[model samples]
Target: MSVSTDLTPPAVILDKPQMAENIGAVARVMANFGLTDLRLVSPRDGWPQERAWATASGADWVLEGVRVFDSVGEAIADLKTVFATTARPRETRQPVRTPRESSRILYDDTASGLKTGLLFGGERAGLETTDIALCAGIVTIPIDPKHHSLNLAQAVAINAYEWRTLILDAPPPRFRDSDPPASNDLLIGMYEHLEEELENGGFFYPPEKKRSMSQNLRVMLGRAAFSEQEVATMRGAIHALARGRGRVLAKLAAERAKASSSSEPPRGE
Candidate 1:
């Protein structure tokens, strides 16, 4: 059986969203969490923003399928269940639940063959009281009390991450690592070669900090966890720099010897 048959993502509704960039970011976060549906109600700058498409990066698919509405009522008109996301307490007596709880409810509703939607408010102002009343419940994220403000796209990302992780079983992140990390011996050789060049260039000034600087350099390189190919590249770069420095130093020594010979008086007479 196909996984799509068993799972249905909730409709993500943005009500009176102000900025086109924020809308684009919401689309990006939605794609990150395997969400696709995007609904807009009365955007300030109008629909089909060139800015939004540019900011979406490669998530043009979400923006392409966007459904525009005149109001929240019209946005989720056909949906039987909906949740409004807000930061503060609403005047309406709607049940307020955490993102996880709201996502769980949505999962249950969608699993049982019911249409569902998630409501988001404008960037400056959250969901209006009337909008909250339309939703069956409110999803509130518990953030630090000192600084509770969350940007429009950030709010979408948080709620979307919760729903995707708790309900949809999001997949692992993709990565590529063909070769193992470089050996310690290779790292030390690279460090020594680079440090010697840096010493010639007087990078470690004041003399007292050279030891600590060396240790810090090693620490920094150690954290890179460089692959064999990356290490090889770095080593090659360092060798080129060192070779250039050697040539310069040799030229300077030759010039100094010529000056000394010219200044010395003839002594064989």
Candidate 2:
């Protein structure tokens, strides 16, 4: 099957959220994963809470476009399929799906023009039993039984990441905007320069082992796969070191000449 490019994102419905910070965090996570539609069903404080904006951390777009409704039914009235997220299971007969499974279903449904929504409960208590009954399915996060409680934003992030995978088949590989590798000519030149320096510095001890030592050095330098700029920088470093050695030798030679003259007898004598 072909990948769907223009799939509609599901609406994020928060049912009776308790704190403004939690709402802000939820919006931030939703923005991170590309879910834009945010709906609130009777937030404890009120809609347009000033604290939410501060906690959102620049995810103003989600907060700006958020919709407020008096009840869950009204909030999700336009949606065709809805899934409720909860850590615990209910006694109802609705099918329970993990975040991953639910995301896959949401992807396919949205691709086929179905308006979908994900319902989340407040921070203190999760989705109400009555609210869970209204959804088409229940989305349960698989957390450790010893510490099953999850933050409101953390729960949203888990589901959002799964939703992101549907758009991108998998996480992309590491990318860098690096220049292309240095050409063979530049690499060869760099290797020769370093080898010449090492030779002058008496780095390769034992004349019999010079060839092997030189080959090992070449291999090590080649492993870096330097760029053009890197090659130039390395050559500059080698030249500077060579100049420093030359200056030291010249100074010693000048000092020896002065010592020899001081010990010579005067011409008049």
Candidate 3:
């Protein structure tokens, strides 16, 4: 087993795709899961499609090197093994395998330096019985019984993600790009500052339930696992809110004093 993320990706063949947009979407998803090889068999809209490139967004490389073929058999001639994607079972006898199972076999083949391919049918109609004949096995994705058909891109994504997971090792994920998680002490300090302002503002008005309210607040904040920067930002926002409220209180007090003085002025007159 290699610790490297890089591995050989299997060839993805789109058979008689009806729409150029769907082909572009398929390319996008394939790029997302690190699969590169893309083959098109008799696209109805023809090749070098402007819509495909536009829909691909920034995945121009996938479309740039795409191989167009006249038929499915011609495309898989170089591949040692080919798996056809199909939703419905045909009357003819062909071994059907799940996405994971098919991907496992693909991984094994690539490990031993064998080229493999995944065949996907058009958007309107899935892989035909005639097309499945060229494949070593059928890959069926288990979906809702009532509506089993999947989008062309979604089918590619499911299989590509599986194949990559089995063949490549992802580095243990971490928030390396952002600040580390805030310590318990820092989070507690933020909570205390916020609660103090809330109390001063009479947010915890019910004296009997103040303890329960604080407990709930603490529980909610504790589960957030805040980052260092996040805690500081929360504290800053609390301070600003308290300052604004203080200004309001001062304004009200001044208004009340002026009103009282005006009322008493009649005695001096």
Candidate 4:
């Protein structure tokens, strides 16, 4: 019934996990190493289940507070550094490290108050190439190459144990250093403002093409969660262009009015 104090509690992310029992077992493993903060990204089995809680047993706290997200990006939205746990290499070319090495790094960064997370793919197919690429690093447990497959909860337990071994002797946890980017309201406002300006500038015009154009623009901007300062600067640029276009239109309208009046044959003769 002992827990490791050296391991930093990670925000454990499970991507499309299949079984509720496996999820509960993972929670138990996390509890064994003093790790909590479970996050589920599109779990195949609906969460907050009695089956999972029953499996978790003494680790009910972890299972009770498990967070659910729609996507991997949303799951780790607040994390500064994330390590992906996978058995196979994928599209991501990030340096692969063993569980022990990853644990040491996680301990160091967590001690310095950096929000870090670890991602575990699903049971059957594992993580997709795109899912792997979303993480900053990859952690693979060293096992026999002849038969290297591991159960979902087993993988979680192994990593959690390694993390605990690394940080057990460190000092108390420190304050987190950085904060997440702007809130959703701020980002949505920026998107709307930019969309309006683009419409005014004839960038997203032709009426028929507006839908696709706006969607593409949203997708591009949405990917790079801009900082507060970046959002402010972008908003300023859009406003400047909009104001400039407004002035030019006003000037053109005045010129047209004056020309039409002057050419009216001296007030209808």
The candidate maximizing lDDT is 2
Report lDDT (CA) for all predictions: 0.78, 0.81, 0.78, 0.77
Flag regions of model 1 displaced more than 4 Å: 1-5, 167-269
* lDDT of candidate 4 over 57-174, digit per residue (tens): 7898898789999987678767756788997875445679998888776776676655788999999978866556556668999999998878999999999888777655554444
Give candidate 1's error at residue 120 in angstroms: 0.6
Model 2 lDDT-worst window of ten? 170-179
TM-score of 2: 0.61
lDDT of 1 by residue, 1-269 (tens): 11343567888999998989899999999988878999999999899898888777789999999999998777886675678899865455557899888887777666655667899999887777656655667788999999988888888888888777755453322243344445444555677788888998899998998876776666456556565688899999988988998899999999999999999998995
For this target, which candidate reaches the highest TM-score against the unseen true structure? 4
- Tell me how candidate 1 scores on lDDT: 0.78
Predicted structure 3: lDDT:
0.78
Minimal lDDT window, size 10, model 3: 170-179
Question: All candidates' TM-scores?
Answer: 0.60, 0.61, 0.60, 0.65
Query: In model 4, how large is the Cα lDDT of residue 169?
Result: 56
| Per-residue lDDT over 1-269 for candidate 2, one digit per residue giving the tens place of the 0 to 100 score | 33345877889999899999999999999999999999999999988999998989999999999999998767876676678898765555567899999988787667656678899998887777656655666899999999987899999999999998878873322243555455445666676788788889998899788766665565456556566799999999999999999999999999999999999998894
- For model 4, the local distance difference test gives 0.77
Pairs of residues clashing in candidate 4: 6-167, 6-168
